[model samples]
Target: MLLINGKVLIHNGEGLNFVKADIRINSSTIKELGEKLTPLPDEECIDLNGDYVLPGMVNSHYHSYTNILKGTSFGEPLEMWSLDTVALGRILGEREMALSVSLGICDMLRSGVTACLDHIPHLATSHIAAKTYKNTGFKSAIAPMLHNVSDREILYEINEIYPVNGKHNKFPSVKDYVDYYIDFINRFHDPKGNVKVILGINSPQRANDELMKAASELACRFNLSIHCHLLETRWQRLSADNDISPLFKLDKFGLLKEQTSLAHCIWMNEDELDLIAERKAAVVSNPTSNAFLGSGIFPLKQYIKRNIKIALGSDGVNCGTSNNMMDILRFLLLLQRTQEMDYTQWISIEKGLQMITKNGFDVLGFDKPFGEIKPNHSADLAIIDKNSFLDILDDSFLNQMVFNASISAKHVLIDGRFVMKDGKISVIDEEGLRREISAIKPYLGKNMRKALNIANEEKKIYKSVYESLLISPSNIQ
Candidate 1:
């Protein structure tokens, strides 16, 4: 395949710059690049027609279960939000799970995202979701969530958040989950293919030491990348016993490694920050979700100065409101400047692009030739229409693209195959998928109603206990 006459964005050692060139792809890798490359006999040709071609964005942290639940909550903290949504995920049937994964895949492709880390909550439905990704031509790391703690355990002090009256829910045993995850990995993980089944530990607060150690063992056993959420809230930071942070606890469990990727380290202190950087572990920052939940600024500048490997993610549509990596890039750039008065301290457009592309490849531990347009690199590219209204504002195409974020890919290629073209997904019937998605509402609603009932009953009991803790005369003294 040959891509001709496109403004190709390349990382020229220092920063991302563009050059009018053509790309020749052999099999799934780029074979050659230059101006007016002659196509070999029987090679297919795609004319970009002066459009901008870029490396497809990577979403290093995402939750597919929440994709179907977008716009359902507003003004809720991460604690309250998790009680409603993660619990609701327990009732989703196989069909509903498949639809949710498909919705997320289509959204990512439309936003020029070629690959993602799907931090899934349910393991039973992962195969269904994995099959959907294969059929849709999307690359993914399907991570089954691991945790031993229950909601009651996490919110023991504020159990009012839990509903008092509801049907009892029994979670799968740790052994049962581990067996399922091993089977899922053996059945789907392909070293030579684009899909992989990774491991996920929910968090230090939610997962016990035994479960965390076992998760680490599984990751090392399978050589798969492991991801877990860490320290996204100030309350979590304050609640750590004896002033030992969650990161320290995770490290103590032997889970911190080069392949480990921690999400949303917003409240991490200097020691935790230094620990992650020293271990060469990756950190995925979800700027929009952090801001939406008021989790606090992520200290992006600090991470950069420490040389910690950093990547960007949309979190999930439910929290971030969109799967567009460019939108996250814009938010990441602007949010830092708002806090730092020094112009040199703010995140540059180049660094933001690197996070979404190059550092993202590092997050998954993929050694494949990717995140660049040079020779031998994977032919994962997004062709953007450069004639948008925002193009006139700046000569730097990257600056305009990140700042405006109003452009979509005119065509997208994953592994040298066109999965989307002319703003339409070519691998599936998108409209038919949209119609099928409507069936999921009743399932989601059923679980949500049950959750709300439980919350209402527990609220009064929890409030009484909580008020005593706050206003008791002995407590005051």
Candidate 2:
């Protein structure tokens, strides 16, 4: 495959330089990238018509099936009144899971993201989503989440709480889940290749100490990145009962490390900041989701000063906003400025762009193949319609990109194969996905309606359950 005749933004602020270059690939690796080379007469040529060709965007953290939750919740915190994840959990079979992942990836791809760290809760079906990348050729770092809070029985007693919507089915043990993930890593992680697995947990608030320790141990043993959600909600913060704060508790349990990557460190105070920077862990900042959930603003300036590697994520833009990683960047940009009331405190375009593109690949622990477009790197890239926006050019590329170039990222490639081209997907039937998604929505709606009704009934039944159980309603308050 050859990506020819497009404006190339090699890396953030490498200062736009023009090139009449050719990007050549064989099998999966980028065979060559430099000035125009005469092709073997048989090589196919793609005319960019002056578009911007760059390394595809990388999503550091995202939920595969969470796209269904977009637009439904106006302003709910992470803990309450949010549409049920369990609802989506009930109706998604392997097919629905694959389509959801495909939809999410395609959304990213079209918006210029070529890679992601997907947080999937169901292992078997999560594998199906990862497999879509193999078929579609997008890069992915998958972490099947393990969330079972057995040790918080005291909290369960004190607060008389259950999982939101109470949708846990057949809990898998920590070791068993770790064993399953290890098998996934063994099968998927390609240190010398592209698609891989990261050791993962859903959140500290939702996981037991055993799982947390096991997750870190497995990630260390395999030398893969550890991914998790941290401080996502106020109630989650309030749930901590011991002297050990959740951040330091993981540290005490030997979980924090250079290889750990946490999503939504929104509520971390100064101490947690020091711990994260000290350990050299990475964070994926989902500004859009943070805004949507009304989770407090993450301390971006604090993290930046400490030299923490931060990446950007859409967080199933459905749950957050839209899947355009650029929007995540834009919102982060405006929000940072607005919250600080100082423009300089805002993460600049150059730095903010790196979060979505380069830093994410760095966080994934794949230094060579994913982010920058260089010789021997995997051919994962996106081509944008440079002329699509007003005043678009190399001169205005950066400005246009961060501010306007977001949705203009119309075409994408992974491993040198055309996954999307000319503002349309290359491999999968975009319409077919829509058809499957449409066909699936009603079944999901029916099942969710049923489950929600049952859950509502359970909530009614349990109204006095907490009262009788010696847990005060004000505890939840």
Candidate 3:
């Protein structure tokens, strides 16, 4: 296949340049990109008609299952937000989880994201999203994450603005969490390509020494990359294990190798920052989610200075508020400038554009010849609306993409195949998924209503116990 006659917005280091380029896709890679390319006799030619071509957006952190938790958790801080989610998750089943993932995938595809790292729980239903990614032409890193913490003191703040909840679970040991990893990869990982079962830990608060150690061993044994949420909130940073940062402790436990990825280090200090740069562990930034949830500004400038690999993610439509990578890039640009009170030294339009394309691929360890459009690179292209940037050209393309571009990606391709076009899913039947999704709501909610009713009754009894305690304290006084 040859994509001929396109105004390619080649994201060159200096700036985005408009070049009259023709891309020849031979199988899963770009055969050539130059002035004139000879096409094979049997090759299919796609005339972009001078449409703008850029690399597809990559999301390093995403929660596909959290899409269903929307509207209910609004205005709550991170702590309350997650507590609300815990209540919601108790009601969710396989079907609801699958529907939420489908909705997340569809939104992400339309929002110009071709690749994503879905940090999902080890649920049978969540695996449907992983399966969908494998069958479609989208790139992905699916980590079946688990949390097993025995103490509340070790747990970090779950959300930015929310207070840490007291200890509520102590049943599952860290060793038990490790045991689940073996089966998780066996069932979900596709060694052929497309899907990879990256071992992911949910958070430091829910993890223990044994769990962290086992994760390190598995990653080393299988050569699988690691993904985990670490040192995100202030409470997590100033927890009982104050000896070091979460990344530092992970490294000390032999978990912070080059293959590891930590999400939303919003509270990282200088020493911790240095360690991440030294270890070469990737940082997945969720700027919008952090900002929206009142999570402090992440150290983007410092990361850029140290040349640490940084990637972008929506975290999930629920946490992130949307599946728009363009919006993330836009927010990041203003965020860095305002945080530092100056932008000239740390970040720029070029860097923001790179985050969506090249930098994102780097986080998944695929940048060199996969993220960018060059000879022999994988043909993962994002076709943007030419009219969207007509008012800006040359250096302005970078400005437009970072500030003015729409979140809707328009069309996307991975491995030289079109997964989405004109905001429609090309690989899956949207109508069928919609029908399945509609049936799921009533089914799961009905069961949830029953469970809630039982909980309500139990709570009534529990309330009496609380009242008795209050009166008993008065009588003792």
Best by lDDT: 1
Give the per-residue lDDT digits (tens) of candidate 2, residues 1-477.
665676666643454443446777776677777667556667777767777777788888888776654554445444433324554466678877787777787678778888888888778677787778777767778888877863223233424565542454357877788878878887777755567787777766567677777877786788877788887654455555333467877787677888888998876767888999899999888887887777778778888889999998877655647777787888888778877876666666767777887788887776465677777877887777766557535366677767765465667777777777667787788899888878878777787677566545444533344345334443422
**TM-score-better candidate, 1 vs 3:** 1
Alpha-carbon runs more than 4 Å astray in model 3: 11-15, 150-176, 240-244, 366-369, 391-395, 443-477
Q: Please name the candidate that would achieve the greatest TM-score relative to the true structure.
A: 1
Per-candidate TM vs. native?
Answer: 0.91, 0.87, 0.86
Worst 10 residues of 2 by lDDT: 150-159
Global lDDT of model 3: 0.70
Model 1 CA RMSD to the hidden true structure, in angstroms: 3.5
Q: Clashing residue pairs in candidate 3, if any?
A: 63-315, 79-162, 149-206, 155-205
lDDT of 1 at 423: 91
Q: What Cα-based lDDT does every candidate model obtain?
A: 0.79, 0.71, 0.70
Whole-model lDDT, model 1? 0.79
Clashes of 3: 4
Residue-wise C-alpha lDDT for candidate 1, range 286-306, written one tens digit per residue: 999988877788888789889
Q: Indicate whether candidate 1 or candidate 2 has the larger lDDT.
A: 1
